[model samples]
Target chain A: MDAKITARQVYKRYPSVDGGEITALEDFSLDVADGEFVCIVGPSGCGKSTFLRILAGLDTASAGSVTITPGADPRKPLNNVVFQEYAIFPWKTVLDNVAFGLEMRGVGKAEREATAREWIERVGLTKFAGYYPHQISGGMKQRVSIARALANDPEVLLMDEPLGALDAQTRKVLQQEFMRIWEETRKTVVYITHSIDEAVLLGDRVILMTAHPGRTKAVFAVDIPRPRSVESTALPAFSDLTYRIWQELEGEVVRAMGEEGQIKIEE
Target chain B: MTRNTLLIALTLIAWNLLFFIAGWWQPLWWLGLGVGFALFIWLADEAGKTAPLRYQRTYEVGLAVAFPVLLLLAWELIARNEILNPRWFPPPTRIAAALWDLTIHYDTFNKTSMFGRPWLFPQTLAAEGWPAAWSLFTESHVLTTLWRVFAGFIIGVIPGIFVGMIMGMNRTVRTMLDGVMSAIYVLPKIAIFPIMMLVFANPFGEGPKIAVVAISAFFLVAINTMAGVRDIDPVYIQAGRNYGANRLQLFRHVILPGALPVIFAGLRLALGTALIVIVAIEFVRARKGVGFVTFYYWEVLVTEKMYAGLFVVMALGVLLTFSLQWLERRIMPWR
Candidate 1:
């Protein structure tokens, strides 16, 4: 299987308040194949978002190099990102927000709007086309953000906890919609989240990460069939994967929580 | 039928009794005339109300019309009767008459120094006759004053915004200039007028009045603009960068838009400053301008002319403010 993204060892260091350094990530490596959906889940501040941001070329890795295999035209969309904070432009209408990427790519107004309307409707935001970001709910804003990323038709879509801000019910509904959208678009996606259930539901493979000098602890193949529903989560296979990943993550999480001689892990 | 009607009747009786006792009118006839006038006013207010509410409509309408009318009458009685000296407070009727004559002679008055000098000031016969618009137009002093205000505002605001934006964006620039600017901003810009006069004294000096107006207005605009630019949010700048926006694009899209509300605020302050400085500058030894006309009237004791000059200044100020408010609404429709 051809890998879409290959990362050798990566190390990232950031400055602390005391003029010393804090290591965010160390000796991190992962491989993702074309058409694959990968989800990364860990405890809080595990540098998952940092990994995704680096993949999106928003930040540079201190040591390792990340490379993407050439596939689609580079001029089209190479990598698109949806930030965690519902990063829709407040000044733009929902339609304009969705159409932003196409507009940036120099698409004509008519063509951009035409294409944007399709995705806007797909995200169930056609009714909100004329509304500004502040007028919409958090879920709807995230939908507009997702539509914006999709409008670019990128080869790789990096999502940094795009659904983390929504209410639980809305999150579930949007997750279901996201699967349908993924099936329709078939874009390679790398999703970062702190939720174990979200990782199991969305990813073909789930990469478990440790905190404080974050590193990939293990990669588990979901091996679950596609066209999956939230109901699929009730199955034994889903529970087994969740339990196994949790089992592996528990040790690293303990180590991560420990300082000096004390090692305490919260349930 | 309503409490308002009763109240109005009572008010009319009271006013009529005052008029009768003061010997301005006969009690019976004036009382009847007052009642009729009150009824007419009440009807005008209640006609639009579906229920014909008595007290509410009459009270609202009565306040609106009667307050100003009463104030004017008091002013006229006080000023014309010398209760308040005409030099200090001209009668409203006399002001109205002067305004009418000014309107009639506006053309000639603008071109000629119709109100400027005692000899140039028209005699009773000429003053009574309507003058040509050419005189008003020929009065270049108003033009000169206006030109100075416009020039000062432009010279002050352009550099102010440019510098303010620079200091606002760069921490180093901000730190370097913030203290200096604070000191300069508070220093009375008008105090420099004497110095300017000494420097530009009588060699093509064109009088230091214009320079004085320019300087005072400049510091006001500059201080406000710096505050405007410095107050822009960093998130806006970061957002622009995330979208692949260059420095220029960041300024054009985010910084400019963010700074606009504050800049308009500065402009408003600067406009007022320009007006004040222009008047103050022209107060000292200037030969022309509304300020000069006002001082000239006061010196020769033409109290009516001075009041007229003041009225003109007030009218110009109101008109300018209204226009700027309209433009502000048009540009920032979202706001």
Candidate 2:
């Protein structure tokens, strides 16, 4: 299979203040086919987010190679990220924030704004096009952030817990939106989340990663039928899939906690 | 009006009326003013607790307007009663009269006037070339200080922001400048006037005074702008880079706008410091500015003119600050 995104033996290490190297990711590897949505779930500090950053070119892997196959249009951006926080510029209006990538790439004003308006409309933020980030609610701001990434039309979308900061209600709405958008566009996505349910619902294959010196533990093909919404969480197959993934994740989460001294180790 | 609102208004009026009839007497005057102020605040706070959005703004403006009026009346009462020697104190009315006098007549001996009668500008310009017209404008006290302030402010702030942006983005540059900037920023700007005079060819001319003011504004703006730029949220910069922004695009779209509100705060501070420095410089060694006008009138013992001169300075500072705030709102409507 020709993969759209590739990461091989991706290793990341940081110099700890204690004068030793702390490995964030060790032997981390993944290959995602074109138009595939891959979700990786792990405890915090597992370096799942680190791997996404490497793939997005925001961070570097110390040892391995990662590349995204560029689209036919040379000018199309390689990748765009939706960060954990609503990283949209506070000073820009919703329309301007969405148009920012095109503007930076030297697109003409009328054309960029038109494209931004369409994306804003698609995200249901048409009424807030002229409003600043401060004027909008957190949910609306995240919508703007998502629209901003989507408007650029990158070859791959890297979401590092994009819905992590939202409330449960808003998260559900955005998760459904994400599934609908993915179904429509089928763009390559590397989604990092702490929620197994989210991974089972959104990804073509769910990749579970072990914590601290993070490495891939298992990959589960979703195989569940589409046209899925939050309603799919009620299905036995979805629940079974989520439970099985969580079973693998449970040991890692505990080990992560014991390492942090939040939960004591008896042995 | 609600009882609290009416009571707040009535308390303000009653204080004014009581002082108007009773006049200001030392212990009683200070005590009454203090007691009345506290009572008025209580009423205003009581009014605010239930006031609708529309009426809250009215109370705010009312409180603002009343406090200064009361201060003016206190000044009048204190001077009229000979409590503070009116010759030096000069009640507000006498100061107003002195201001009017300065406005109407040019003081040929001092070579100064409030505005040099701008109504004659067309006639003057027709009869005279640039030099003559320029000389005529420089004779006005208000215009003289204003020109020096504007010139020094523009000269200082432009380079200040440019250098500040440089220092902000470069760690080495910032570290190199930080210590010296901190030292100079606190030193009294008026103390530098003598050195600035030695540097200029014409010590007594406009050069040294404008230079001193410019220097004061420079350090203030440079340091403040550097802080403003350095303090910008880092995530925005990351977002800019991730969006395919080049260096110039990142600077334009992220760094500058992110630093703007703090930069404007720096501007407001620099403007205040600039005015204070120029006025002090004029007081020591000049003949055509508001500070010089105030000092000259004091030398001749026309105390009211001195107070008028001071009034003009206060008005200039307030007017400049308000103008800066308006410009800020225009530039950063996002705020």
Candidate 3:
């Protein structure tokens, strides 16, 4: 399989408030194949978000390298991120927010608006085309965020806990929509999440990282057959795969919690 | 009264007692005001609990307007009963009559009228031309003050937004000028009128008056604009960068729109400040503005006309505020 995203020896460090150097990521490396759905799950503060930010080119690795494969079209954006916060511009209407990426790419207003309208329709937000981000629900805002990234037609789609802010029922509904959309488009995806079931249900491979100085600790291939739906979560194979990943995740999670407790106690 | 209401009234009385014992800032007027407020609160509570005036709609607007009406009624009663001197503290009806008189009559001495005689404009324009309209507008006290405020506001707000954007985006610029801006901001704009007079060709002319208004407005606008820019969520900036927005594009797409609401807020405040500075400057210096007309009445001991001048200023305030609200609604339809 041709590697669409390649990172080697990615090391990130940040200066603490007390002026001590803290390592966020150490020797973290992974290769995601072309058109692969890769979900990264780790304990809280495991640098999953930090790594995604680096991949999206919003931040640089302190040392080592990360790269996304160039598209044939020079105008194609290298990657677009669907941030956890649903960072849709509040001043912009849904149509405008979805068209923002295309607008930034210097696409003409007519073409971009048309493209944005199509995406808005696909996201089932045609009625909300003129609605600002503040006027919409959390789920609706996330839909706009997703539409925005897809409208850009990026080489790599990066998401950092995109559905994490949604209520549980909304999350499940969006998860189904996510599955359907991913099946149709088949874009190279790198998603970060805290939900094991989500990682199992949606991802081609679940990549788990260790507690703090986070590095890739394990990779589980989701053997579930595709054209999968919400019904796929009910399969025996899905639960078995989820349980297996949870077994490895348990120790890392405990260690990460202990570190949090120590920091609070010290404070 | 309920225990809570009773406690509050006692607390207010005790607060006055504490101040009285300390022999501090408590005056007769202060004690009276506090007692009046406490009495009002207690009465309001009793009324709400006992009478319980329930309706399909609220009386908030009615209550608001009623206070002024009640105050005016009390003033009329006090003045009629000779509780205070009526000449200096003229009755509200006298003030209203004076306002009407001021509106209709033109002062040949000051060589200016209140509204430049809009009634004569059509005949003048037919006899003369468009310049007649402008000449008439210039000859009015209200128009003169309005022009100064308009000129100062336009001059101040544009540069304020630009400089503020620069200060907001560039840390080095902000750090270098932030202290300087703050220092100048706190210095009363009216206090620098003398320096402005010295700087201009005409010491007591419109130059210093307008310029002082501009300076006051500029600092207010610039400071608020910087805050607006700073207050934009960093996440949006990150999103802009990630989506291949170059420096110019990021500013145009994200920064400008994001900072606009705050910029409008600053503009609103700066406009109010400009009006104040211009009026005060006119009071001290100019011969033709509304401020001059108002102060002139006071100097001549025409108490009713002085009240009329105040009423005109308030009318201008209401007009300007409503116009600004209209403009804001036009510009920010999304809000």
Candidate 4:
């Protein structure tokens, strides 16, 4: 399979308040094949979000390069992000927010509005297309955020814990929605999350990262069959795979806790 | 009667008895009235404590109306009995009468009226064209003040937003202007009237007055716009850029709308400042604005007319505020 995204030896450093440099990512590398759904799971402060930002070109890697191979259609954006905060503009109606990316690309008003309306329908927000973001529920806002990213027709989608802010039930429902959408479009996606269930359920391949100057620790392929859904988690193989990945992640999480000595494990 | 009601009735009776027995107004009698009023209020409060929940709103409305009416009655009585000088502090009734006179009195000599005699608007329009009709409509001191405020507010707000947007986006510009803006913002805009007068060719014309109002509005708007722009979420800007928005598109789609709520807040503040500065300027120099009439009435010691002029100023403030709120609703429907 051809790689849609390529990254090599990526590094990120920030100037700490104590006047010393703090490394966030060290010697990180990733290559996502075209139409692949990859989830990067890590403990807190593992720099997964930073990596996503670098791939989205919102931030530069301190070293090495991240690039998205251009598709045959040059009009498409390289990547579009679905932010954790569901950063839909409060001033814009749902339809307008969905059409925002197209508008930014100089798409004609009628065409963009039509496309936005179509996406809004796809996200089951047709009735709420005229409503402002503040007037909608958090789950609905995330749907608008997702529809906006998709409407941009980007080569890659970068999501940073898009479902992290939602309640458990809403998160599960959206996970199903996301699965269905991905099944339909097969767009290359780089999803970051702290939830193990989410990573295992959504991604074709789950990549684990270690904490403190994060680097790829392991990659697990889900051999579970195609057309996955919330019911797919009921299969014995699903829990076996999830348990196996958790075993790998648990050691890194414990090592990270020991290194920081700040995390309090709650009941 | 209920205990609380009886207590309230006795308080009122005692209030009347004290004034009737005095047969003459005294400062001491006022003290008696105050004590009786306090006792009555206490009794009313006690009565309300036991009232049904459904009656609470009614009780509140009654108190709201009765308190202000009672105050006005006291003012009328005091003024009529000459306890306070009526010449300087005319009663509300006299002020109302004066306001009515100002509304109807059209001075043929000065060719001006308080409200331009709207009753005669059709005649003016038929005898002349739309210009004359508009002139007649705006010939009042009220309209003159309104026009100045509206003009100055627009002139000040437009550029204020522009400069504020630039200052908000660029750190270098913001830092360069921060101290200067703070210094000027704190200064009283009226203090610059003399300089404005010197700058304009005609000191008595509308130029200097409008300029003062504009300057006051400009600083407020510029400062507010900068704050608004700076307060926008960085994520939105990043999203806009990632979606292929050029600089102008980014500004139009993201920065402008994102900062609009704060900008409107600034516009409101600037509008109020514009009204204040224009009034002060009119008080200092103009021959035909509401503020000018107010000060003129004071010079001639016509306290009732002076109060009427103040009432006009208040009315103008309300009218302008309502108009701006209407505009704000139209511009920011999402809010």
Candidate 5:
């Protein structure tokens, strides 16, 4: 598999209010292959979102470089993001929000509308295409967000805990929907999440990171069979893999919580 | 009868007896009237409390209508009986009659009419072309006020939004202008009318009046637009940029829409301020506006006509508000 995204020793630092520098990411490197679905799971403030933002070209690394190797089509956007908040414009209808990326790229109105309608239909939101963001449920809004990212036909998708805001049942349903969509498109995606189960279920490879100046802890290859579903999570192999990843992440999570004063460690 | 109804009936009888039969037109009689009214209101409140949920809305509407009708009746009675100085505080009927007179009476000396006799618009159009028909509107005080508001509102809001956007996007610009803008925002716009008059070449022309109105609107809109732009969620801007939107596209797709709701709020405020500033300006100088007519009527002790002018001002406010709401709905369909 050819590598489509490469981040070499990325570092991010922010000036604290007290005049000292706080590191967000330190010596962070990631390589995502073509047609790969990679999930980066970490504790809160682990800088996984920061890394995704850097890849999306929304922010720059303080040190080092992150690059996306352009595909054959120059017209296609390099990457599109699925924000955690769903970030859909309240002033736009569902169809318009879905078509926003194409519109921004100067696509003709007719072509963009057609494409947006097609995606809306795919998301089963055809009936709601004319509805504003405020008129929709959170799960439905997130679907629109996903459809928007896909409709742009970008080379890569960067998702920042897209399903994190949803209830458990909605999250599971969307995870299945997302898996099905990824199976169809095979677009390279870098998904960030705190949910270990989500990382195990969605990604071809799950990368775990340590907190406080986030760095890679472990990378686990999910050798599970293709065309996985929610039923796969009931299987012994799936549970064992999830358990192993959790075992690797548990110490990092506890340490992070302790540092944040959310938890106390005994000796 | 129910206890509440009985109490209300007794209160009404007591109110009339205290005024007519007792011939007690002193401070004590007035106190008795107040107590009687309070008792009636208490009975009404009790009735409202006991009303069924489905009938609650009917009760509210009844209260709304009854209070205003009762107040108008009291005013008519008080003015007719000379309880208050009728010359200064004319009854609602007199104000309505005065308004009717203003509508029909065309002043030959001033060459102006209240509505330019809009009833004659069809006849004017038939006798003359569009220009002649347009003259009917131009020769009215109402039209003058409307023109100033519309012109000043447009002139102020457009550049106000532009400069506000600049202030919102650039941190340094925002820092530089924040203090100055804040200081000016709270200053009463009417206080600067004298300066505006001095600045214009014609002190008594439309220039100073419109400038005062425009300046009032500009500050309100600029401040509101700045807050609106700054208040937009940063994630939307990030999404726009992430999707390969350049500066203009980001503004069109993200910033403008995000700021629209707040901008509309500002527009509404600016509109109200514009009306106030124009009226104040007219009061101070202009010879051909609703405010001018109102002040003129007050000067001549024509209380009814003065009240009519107040009525016109209120009507203008309602009309302008409705027009703005219509425009806002058209522009922001998603809202």
Candidate 6:
């Protein structure tokens, strides 16, 4: 029950055109416990990515503060991220891209290469070790991104819609792989995604957020056990959880549609 | 025949109208030339329809070259027959003869005196005075101009990238340098040559030439580097920074690599500017280089030798352009 990352009363707002400010997250607060996987789901543009950025220290909350608990050890702290676009460097090979974090940490060349090679083999990309980011498909690229983030062995892994661009078949495969990896590593993970099935399959807890000054509407603890499969969506508990989250999410989606109309009218 | 006949009829009708209105045979000659050109074009078109495209293309090319030669021969024959003035519109054969005399018998145009003094202006092809190749060996004025150009290009490009990169990296640096760079960029560089020479002095005798070349090259490189840096994707910096990169590390890892293609762009522009300034400098006053050769030949109205020097300058420009392009390809193999 020990919280790994604590965010208390986090509020973030961005300025819009014509001097009006758009509130992204308002009075948002969440706690991620050690070795737990949580999924944050919201309508498009509900500031899930913004909240993640604040946690990553890329952006500061406008009103509140976010702190990592007892702090990260100077040797290895908690947070690493796998971005939605698979932000792998195009110029680097799959192996070098994965090794970049290790390289930054002053890891020896031989050791870093060995670690990278091990991860590449784990991700089923041993054959593509020398291939550049652009040469691979989106699914393969995401695997490389996963390999890179995990290579750092961070305590808390923040994934921002990491499987958002993949085909349905590939997404299902990666979700299973993600569960396997999580079971193996037992790392605290905060994943941002829109897919209800994804939220159910991968996350131990699902945080459904409302739009227009995005705030958490409800939190659901998934009753599903370990090694959950994509086929579990057919089960009563899976559909019930998805239906439950959608009830809170549908109103925000409509509100977002209304906002889009207003924005078009204003334009 | 249907299309050719129709075109011929239209052309003849147009010519008759002109002849009637102007009361001149000039329109008839124009009609004749048009007919001659049209006939060849029609024949080629018809021939293309019967033959394979490649063979037709080859025949068309032959016709293109042959038609021009035939026109020149006809004009020469007509002029020689006193159909045209020999004084102003000399026969092509006579011009060819004149060219042969100018190229072969050297004394016709330029004849050197018993002393080493340049007496007559040498014709273009005449191997008189010093062979053009001699400039490549000695400390000729042409060599001086080229040296100044290269020196200026190097001096200008080196600091240009350094300053540009610094400004590009930081917003404050960009704000401070942008205005100064803009002002220098707009100013007429040629007009400031006198001032630069006055301030610096031809201390090395070749100092002003080299200074002018360097000055011209610097702004181009700097501005380009600044632009390159400014246009770099912020994602690269953010990516490096997120990975615990320091400022120097970010520069080495992300900034320089991302800005390289753009820096190469600046170098190419600076090189062109360097060449222009060096030539202009030599035109004013210089001890060596092709620019001096051009100026020296032009002063005595040795038009052909001036052209020869100009050809060398053109060759140099081509050489530099290809060399830089090769270097860019070598460095940025991915591009």
- Among these predictions, the greatest DockQ belongs to 2
Model 2 accuracy (lDDT, Cα): 0.88
**True-vs-predicted CA distance for residue A240, candidate 4, Å:** 3.0
TM-score on alpha carbons, each prediction: 0.72, 0.95, 0.90, 0.89, 0.91, 0.75
Segments of candidate 5 deviating more than 4 angstroms: A262-267, B1-70, B125-135
Worst 10 residues of 1 chain A by lDDT: A258-267
Q: How do the residues A94-161 of candidate 5 rate in per-residue lDDT, one tens digit apiece?
A: 99999999998889999999999999998889999999988999999999999999999999999999
Best candidate according to TM-score:
2
lDDT of 1 by residue, B96-174 (tens): 7765554445334334342323334355336654353334433644565666777776777787777777877778988
* lDDT (Cα, tens digit) per residue for candidate 4, span A1-267: 999999999999999777988888999999999999999999988999999999988899999989899999998898999999998888899999999999988899999999999999999999999999989999999999999999988999999999999999999999999899899999999999999888888898999999888999999997788899988899998899889989999999988888777534421
For candidate 6 chain A, the 10 contiguous residues with the lowest summed lDDT are A69-78
Q: Write the per-residue lDDT of candidate 5 for residues B1-335, one digit (tens) a residue.
A: 37777778787777777667676544354565567668768877877887889999999999988987777776776777677888999998999999999989988887778888888899899999799899889879999999999998888889899989999899999999999999999999899988987998998888888887888888899988999999999999988888778998889878998999999999999998899888888888877889988998999999999999998999899898999999999999888
Minimum summed lDDT over a 10-residue window in model 3 chain A is located at A208-217
lDDT of 3 by residue, B163-236 (tens): 99999999999999999999999998999999999999989788888788888889988999999999999999
**What C-alpha lDDT values do all the predictions have?**
0.75, 0.88, 0.88, 0.89, 0.89, 0.76
lDDT of 3: 0.88
The lDDT of model 6 is 0.76
Give every prediction's interface RMSD.
3.2, 0.8, 1.0, 0.9, 1.1, 2.1
lDDT of 3 by residue, A1-267 (tens): 789999999999999989898888999999999999999999988999999999988888999899899878978988999999999998889999999999988899999999999999998999999998888899999999999999999999999999999999999999999889998999999999999999999999999998678898999999999989889999999999999999999999999999999999999
Question: Sorted by TM-score, highest first, which candidate order results?
Answer: 2, 5, 3, 4, 6, 1
Kindly indicate the candidate among 2 and 3 with the higher DockQ: 2
Docking class of 2: high
lDDT tens digits by residue: candidate 6, A1-267: 899889999999899998999999999999989888999999998999999989877788999878776445666745778888787776568998899778877889999999999999989999999887777899999999999889977778889999999999999899888787778888889999989879988888999888888898899999987777777777899988888888878888999889989989999
Q: Model 1: per-residue lDDT, tens digit, A109-222?
A: 999999999999999988889998878899998999899889878778889999998999999999999999999888889999878888999999999998888898888899
Give the TM-score (vs. native) of candidate 6.
0.75
**Model 3: residue B10 alpha-carbon error in angstroms:** 29
lDDT of 6 at A57: 75
Off by over 4 Å in 6: A15-20, A69-73, A166-180, B1-145
